[model samples]
Target: MITATDFITIPYTSDLTQAGIAYACRSLPYTYDRMGGSHFNRLRRIVVGVAVELAFRRRLAEEKVPHDNLGSTPFTDPDRYDIAIGGRRCDIKSFMLTRRSLIRHVSREPQALLGADALVPSDQIVSDHLNDEDLYIFAFITALTTPNQRSLDRALKADQPIYLIHPLPKEWAHPSRWIPLGTLALKCDTSHAVTLELGGQNESRAFMAEEIVLEPRKRAAAESDFYALGYLHTSNPPDGIVGVHSPSVGETHLVEPIQWGNIWIYGMQIIFTGYMTRGEFRQRGNRLPAGSRVFKYSSTRTENRSLPIAELHPLSDLFTQAKKWAKRGA
Candidate 1:
């Protein structure tokens, strides 16, 4: 049985370095195109995979457990697994828990077929590539809902737990191609038939009558205190200052600015940063000098405060410093 001892925790830190940020800004446009246009949500999903993989690998290394990382292997390869431990192939499946009690299905396909016997057996849909000898590890992580930069920074620094389940038998594994029971019974168009190749024969099937009722099962698990891993920050400091802002009070407050890159760090944990058009800045609130640009420090929060002219750095200087830092890191 999988126990608490089997799990490992990996810390999360801001990986944004001067060079990394510079590279990201330069290449993100091309990368987004190559990833199929501006699908930020899709890109975020891929990043979660990367984070989980890295955390697992780090834990293995720390425990002195010998394992081979096979993530670079092509997905089409039958032997592809996330890691190999003691010659046992282990595949990692990760999902995000949006709420305290639920996890939505990852599969986008319909779950049931159209007929008197509409429930599709789970075994038929399981991938043939997964060998019987291979073990499955499911990693369920928490999702953050920070609305502002302050909250985001705090969430990133805070220790979040990851629940893991292991050795899930291949026989119990379900296919990602499953449709909702309600959709299958009521909304499915009878005229549109689905073709399936089964047992060396091509079969075309049409939707059943609306009177058919198939109950949908809740795939998510209840809350449990499983083994969890915590994310910690690395030794390296932040790449650059994003911006600077102070809390709004009746009395004027002195602002202290620390420059990192194009952004400024101030008030200890808060980062001052954001871009706005000259017209928008003037029309919305206070205006700076005619040639000067204005950047909102607390853009993510409801309370707004403007940086004093003396505390503000020229945009040109920030870019130059960022370039220098990038080269130094390189």
Candidate 2:
């Protein structure tokens, strides 16, 4: 059983977030959601992934562990490997734990968060995913239960229990505070002019309701939590899995996306649950047919595989092993 102790939370700095967003933006033209989903959402995912890779690299250095930085961003340029340990290449896959999943885990006393799945999209599982990588590190990022900390503060101030967490992001049954421009076009009156801003850039611009069409821009003006990284300005595609919310009211609905990717680039935390190597994963991972529900985003894109968080080797074990490899190499 994986205890909470095995899960290490690394909070990132503004500089890291900025680097991640810049990398994501530059790579936006090259990389995309192979499954044919929201391109805006794809940018958010890439940002979160790079953040995790960068943070983990810093952690390895701080611990004095031997490793090689493989440049986690610019998506497909060199290869899929993010970093290497003991000459072993690693590819990191990120998954978002739904708000409902978080709440359920919180309520269960001493509950081992065992069932969280590290997702691998089906098509990428072949050409996109480099099978030669020595290991796979699956990390999970979370969203604030409420729209923002203020919402949580208001609930606590009123002496009320916070129970408004929904199961999936961008769900119609439980609408997220963050709505993307495309989704907003569908829901809100677009005739009125709306002002928008990029994540870190100063000054805002006005968009006619009609101009707020749903699509990914080379660059989007959004209100990002990191200030440096900025916000994810896109349509919040309604789905049963992970979602990004609209921007806030004071920020003119410039809600930072709480989805796995958006949060970190916009200054959110991610947890390192555990890891498994490619050979072992290929041997043990459960094969899910195309369109199987996996975590926040449904893997409707193609057939994919998944492994439970509980089944992964503890990060401590990985670190300990890395230390041994360093000694041998020395």
Candidate 3:
């Protein structure tokens, strides 16, 4: 769904190695270890950012455009701006595209005041780097999804035909378009930061910002090949496990015990649930079932060592009822 207009294509010219990329990832504000990727997502971002800067520098040199690569000096502070052109400091913000749109964490703090109903902009929303920079340049890069496809991976592997890069519209420079940093509602955890709604009902279909499709390597696969039964400890199920739509199956599958570990008895029935890989769970938009707190068994521990079958309730009974209803409708 990506189009040529969405990017500002640049040729690969940097000699930056993967080790350098990994080092930069660690140096950045959100360190690589905390970035929640099973592998490589953060590294890709760092590489792409450096590539864009290098490419921009090359283009400027060829055209005799005046600019200072602040990053070039031996004494250049890591805190200094990326580049200075025509006396204006420009900082490059790079993001990876998924489902044809970019989803980035814009602020460390909420955009508005916490615990307040009004949407007034917060003074703390501005960072020291943002305040010092005269202009912000955003670069969007595409991650390779298939084995034979052309992508940023090609550039990383030193293959021909590197990944495509694009610059967002000039309007993004405006502060209003920036993703808000604050909570969507009061009392929610700070980790639940706000995001910008890029498209609405009337927008063109091709430009909509859909759910991010994380690459296989970037996600953790299911622990075991087979599914098992688990028990739901609480009567209330989590929002994602309870009502969210699953695009893969075309219909929401009732929360079934996919993997079993610990057993809990509620009334006369044993409530069972199973382990879902972080990848599969993220497909449900990263929601966890409500009673996740009560079920603390590790996903890596596949065998149910202690529980007896006599005390465990069968999940097949619920699945059988669902199948019977489907046949009657048919």
252 Cα displacement, candidate 1 (Å) = 50
Give lDDT tens digits, candidate 3, residues 1-330. 112222234433225333334333233322323224422344354555555555555645664555656654221134435676544565554433332221121112111111111110122113454443254343333333312223423433653332211111122211122232111111111122211111111111111121222221232112111111111122111122211121222332233222111111001111111111122222222222222221121121111112111222222332344345446655
Supply the TM-score for candidate 1.
0.30
All candidates: CA RMSD in angstroms?
29.1, 11.7, 30.0
1 versus 3: better lDDT goes to: 3
Decreasing lDDT order of the candidates: 2, 3, 1
For model 2 the TM-score comes to: 0.59
Instruction: Put down candidate 1 lDDT per residue, 1-330, tens digits, no spaces.
Output: 122222232333334122222222222222322113222222333444445555556655764555667655432222335675544455554443343232222112111100001011123114464444443443434444332346435544764221111111111111122222111111111222221110000012111111121112211111211111111111112222111111111121111112111221010011111122222222333322222322211112212223222222222332344355446655
TM-score of each: 0.30, 0.59, 0.31
Among all candidates shown, the one with the greatest lDDT: 2
- Backbone clash total for model 1 is 22
After superposition on all CA atoms, how large is the RMSD of candidate 3? 30.0
